[model samples]
Target: MRLFVGGLPPDITKRDVEGRFAPFGAVAGCDIVPSKGLGASPGECRGFAYVDFEPKDNASLARCLSL
Candidate 1:
């Protein structure tokens, strides 16, 4: 399952997101949405991200905690 994490701090990184959700379950992948417009770096996030998990159950648990 793919989970959308929004309102993330500008300084947040992919490793940070993985670490936070690691306790919940294995993270298949994580991608922070890049900021748009002039002077935006690839490493910069648009205050949001998408985290992928193997099983739906783990994703569901993470979702609950996020809320």
Candidate 2:
């Protein structure tokens, strides 16, 4: 299941997100969405991130993550 993360630090980086989520499970991918006026390129995290994992177990692992 896809989940939404919120309440992250503005300066949060992909590496930082990976590190924080590593304990969760094998992250399929990490994306830091930039704001609209931010520009054509993706900017730093706007206080949230999306972490993709393996299976249902991964979803359970994600449950461990929160603000």
Candidate 3:
């Protein structure tokens, strides 16, 4: 499953975000979308991210809904 996370701190890192969701399930991948605009670097956090979880017998869905 892919989760769209928003309202994150600007300084948060991709590893930081991945660690957060690690407890829920196996993280297939994580990517923090960089802010895009004048003065924004390519590596800047956009305050949003995409977290991909490896499906495990619907466990991911259950855990997420329980949150």
- Residue-level lDDT of model 2, residues 12-56, one tens digit each, is 788888787767677777787665553534675677777777675
Across residues 1-67, which tens digit of lDDT does each residue of candidate 1 receive? 7889899987789999999987777788999998998887767889999988878567466677799
Question: Which residue pairs in candidate 2 have backbone atoms (N, alpha carbon, C) closer than 3 angstroms, thus clashing?
Answer: none
The lDDT for every candidate, in the order shown, is 0.84, 0.69, 0.85
Lowest summed lDDT over 10 consecutive residues: which window, candidate 2?
35-44
| Cα lDDT of model 3 by residue, 1-67, tens digit | 8888999987899899989988888888998999989978768898999988887725756766688
Model 2 CA lDDT for position 40? 35
Cα distance off (Å), candidate 2, residue 64: 4.6
Poorly placed runs, candidate 3 (over 4 Å): none
**Index of the highest-TM-score prediction:** 3
Backbone clash tally (model 2): 0
Give the candidate order by descending lDDT: 3, 1, 2
